[model samples]
Target chain A: MPVFPRFTALAESLPPTVPFVGPEAQERTRGARFIARLGANESGFGPAPSVIEAMEQQAGLSWRYGDPENHDLRERLGAHLGLAPDRIVVGEGIDGLLGLIVRLIVEPGTPVVTSLGAYPTFNFHVAGFGGRLVGVPYRDDHEDLDGLLAAVKRENAPLVYLSNPDNPMGTWHSAAAISRFAAALPETTLLVLDEAYSETAPVSALPDIAALADMPNVLRFRTFSKAYGLAGQRIGYVFGNRETVSRFDRVRNHFGVNRLGQVAALAAIEDQAWLSHVIALVVASRDQIGDIVRGHGLKPLPSATNFVAIDCGGDGARARTIMDGLVSRGVFIRMPGVAPLNRCIRVSTGPEVEIDIFEQALVEVMAELNGL
Target chain B: MPVFPRFTALAESLPPTVPFVGPEAQERTRGARFIARLGANESGFGPAPSVIEAMEQQAGLSWRYGDPENHDLRERLGAHLGLAPDRIVVGEGIDGLLGLIVRLIVEPGTPVVTSLGAYPTFNFHVAGFGGRLVGVPYRDDHEDLDGLLAAVKRENAPLVYLSNPDNPMGTWHSAAAISRFAAALPETTLLVLDEAYSETAPVSALPDIAALADMPNVLRFRTFSKAYGLAGQRIGYVFGNRETVSRFDRVRNHFGVNRLGQVAALAAIEDQAWLSHVIALVVASRDQIGDIVRGHGLKPLPSATNFVAIDCGGDGARARTIMDGLVSRGVFIRMPGVAPLNRCIRVSTGPEVEIDIFEQALVEVMAELNGL
Candidate 1:
């Protein structure tokens, strides 16, 4: 039978493909689990023990819906960020929050600017809302700030996205430079500053809360998925000027965030010592990955985040082959989708045991590919 | 400073008000804890102990994002329902799923039909997407199926909503009546069949899966939040024609469901005995509530679901006063928002301890108000 024919034209035009094929899907397809999960950049270090305990303690309370307003978690997030509670809106992770902000701002054929090959999920949301995406190619392996600003101005784009301590390439810009970029944008343009990797980035890589707190055009997105090790919990928040941030309330599913996620996030924030400890481990793991890749005669990109992007000394095709070979060899890793950046493979930092497996798998895969 | 100026006109036009204020928000406003939690229709008996144990066991693995496809849960759900896995789509919750389906079909000025005093969250989504809503008033406390069908034909509405074992009034239509209603709908009018209360509803109240499974335009939404007592986990599913259900994947946030929630829901489904136990408790509690209201000259509506809506034999004003009086007396109960239905106060079935508190509070409030 024919499907319902009344879906919006834009919905009909959209493709059903998702942004990422998760590692779990890959295992199902391969019919074998990977020995090391270094893809997706999730921390194998896991959430804090205290956070787990808190989740366990409240497991029986799952019958109660999460607070629709997310009062307590937002209050805690406010104090943590030195902003008022009204400035923050917690959601089902940065991805879910991205969809909401896009819905609030985007309309059919509206131009949205972003670095080419940046977060695909953000791009997916733009397309879902019928926004025309203007891609600014990277400059010298970094998001070209000048190019992005020019596109925003030329297209009169109302939305732009940038992830600092960036993903896939593991590149970053100084806080001062990021602040200058934000200042240059027209007030009508809303900047989505994704800081999903902030906790693992160097101190110099982050802007102080007060620097961009008053910018009505900027919403900084952060998540516990990275250094905080709660990607599975799906807790992400965006904070900015009260009026601008409050626009989210106009369209968000008020009770969207799961209850135990709120509980776990609250506990994760309170355990700063655990965060610090994880950051240290991530730094060491990044170095270990760097050393391992270099020993195999590959270039490791400088990284501020938990993952290292190893230059495979070839193009996107070569990178794909190596990544596939590693996957077949029981290693789970990823690579950039677009060219230039795609010349490298991205591996997340995790426990030494997992890294050791990645090292062994990489060695065999490289030798096999070289022989071919 | 002003907020960003380029938000879409529809978004700017939307009110920032939410569909419902949570009980937690009420407690914050009153500056006191509720003595009896009976509002929101969440199960007070909580999730099955096995579900809780499963959540705790998997709490440490929360660093990994849940399978973007929800493969395992959907597989189990498909087997349980005797439907193919492709016909089911799992999402953040029924609220989140409603938002997605609405986004798919409801463009600006799209006509949608529903009962006057139905699920407000569904209406909230329709408004969020700029859909024009046509409300058909309930006929004698039950959804007016004939009125709804006439409205759909008049408006040529692309979407219609019907919740069985209905909310606020605790009434239901038999399987035959509902099946006939679905058959009467235009092929182009997609039906959103919400069965959130199905587990607590009598067997005669629900249609067999085969009865409407072949209809391309009918989507039945079910939830773990009701009888399974996993409201806080925010897991809900919609199953229907594979082609129609697949449309959700075009825009859904793949990782929106939290990891532990998926684990908890899976465990909850596996423990069918606990579900039966909770249903029994809800029936007894409903009877207890009926006795308490009848003892005071109030009339209890016949209920197939886990709540009782009591008629105060007056107007909305009287019902409001009694509801407010109960609130002040530390009993948390709710009433419908529209007139006619507003003359009745709704109390959710719960543990006897909480129901006992509600009974005592209601008696004192009635006596005090009568004296006044």
Candidate 2:
């Protein structure tokens, strides 16, 4: 049969990749479910009881389309962030919102900058939109603010991404440093400050909302997926100057955010006690993971977010071997994609049960690797 | 503050309107909630007990992201449609899927065809992608098949859309007529066959899945929103020749579909008994709505969807007056945005209570309009 012709030249040139293969796909290939699911940085601790109740209540209301304005949730978020509701735009997820943000700014050959080992989904969006990606390598296992700013200046890229308390490497810089970096960027550069892990990071590591509130070019992305345990709902929001944030309205799927997600997020936000509890558990789990890494003669990078990146004390190939070994042994975790950073195996903080499974599997995988 | 300076020329050219002025937005403007929501074609009958149960059960499991592959839902849907799983790609909703299809085929200045008074969301997407939309006006009430094919040929449009059992005006074309239309389109023109209202549509109005399955350029979109009462869940899928459907993977937000939505859709598809029940309810509600329209001295168009579009026996002004009167009485409904079609008021089928409210509000609105 003849195939449909006329896919944009960009689409035709793109490679077919099943990016960010989920643990489920890995499990399907391995023919068994993993005992530990510490990858993807999802909160294994689960949503609060109040959130569960809210979801149960709203499950029937799922018949109605959610408020296209995402008014109620945005109002609650604004109150929490000390910003006006118009300054925020809720979306399917940070991934979904990032796609819209890119679409608004990126035409073919538009230059976009980010750390070499930053979130691949953001890069995927950049590539999907035909943005020319300029990646700067991390400095000292952290997203190098200086390097990213330099690249933005050099490329004159309109869009640059920075994820503080960054992923994969699980390292962070102080709020003061991040604020300085934001202030240093050229006014033409739009900094996509991804704060997906901000909930689990230390207070000192997070810049106050007021610091970037006046900067029209700086938009911060946050999600309920991390500390609130709502990744499955795919609810996230981005906030910046009201004028800049309003641009999402032009392109976003107006009714894309799930109704139950809205309910769950509202309840989760109101349940401060639960968030505090999860944060504490995350801290403990990170420490536990660090101990296990040390016991294996690996170095665990100090983390502000809910995950630790353990240097496997070898090269990228060795880390891949260990990750595969862990998967085969019913443990699920992830690693950075690019080299240097790929020398580490990233494990997310989760409940004790999964942590125990990870600890046990790590020992077995090490023995199997060393013995072989 | 100076806004982010380099939004694409296309983005800057777009309007700042919220676009979909949802009922929630209406209520906010009116300073009150609508007593009845019949505007969006959402099933006021709600989802089945079993689907709700499935969502409730999965409510606590909201910590994990849905499978990016949408493996299980696609597999189940394949069995239901007699197509291979590879032929189906699930997304946030048909609205979202439409956006992807447009992006895949549409470049700036690309001509895309749809009925003038058809789904506005599809037009919104086409505009967002900088596609020059060529609209064919509805023939009588149904989307004009001949006109669409002519537009495609005339402009050599790479993409053309047709929604059978159409919206705004709840009328339909026979399956045979549609099959002919599909066979008639140029192979280079990708036809988006929107079957969102198919479940409520008579089988005679639906072409057999295998009839169009072999055509690489014909993609059919279906959803759980209208019939299955899962509108808020935002789960919809598009199916076609596997090769054509595969393009969606290149640009789709892979993890955009929510996990509970997957659960709800799986259960909704399995609960065929509930689907039968909802269809019966929709039919009965349509009849009741038609009676109300006649009582108001209007003519309800023959419907193959879950709503009735009643011609107000005057111009667009009369329809607007009645619709506004209904809105003031807290009866939520909608009408087409284009002329001729805008002469009608559209009401979605819902629960008995909402139907009763509509009936009462229509009588009051008529009396008020006549008195004035």
What Cα-based lDDT does every candidate model obtain? Answer: 0.94, 0.91
Looking at model 1, the pairs that clash are: none
Segments in model 2 whose C-alpha atoms lie over 4 Å from true places: none
Error of 2 at A75 (Å): 0.3
lDDT of 1 by residue, B139-230 (tens): 99999999999999999999999999898799999999999999999998999999999998889999999789889899999999989999
Best by DockQ: 1
DockQ each candidate and list the results. Answer: 0.92, 0.85
TM-score, chain B, model 1, is 0.99
Residue-by-residue lDDT tens digits, candidate 2, B75-127: 99999999999999999999999999999988889999999989999999999
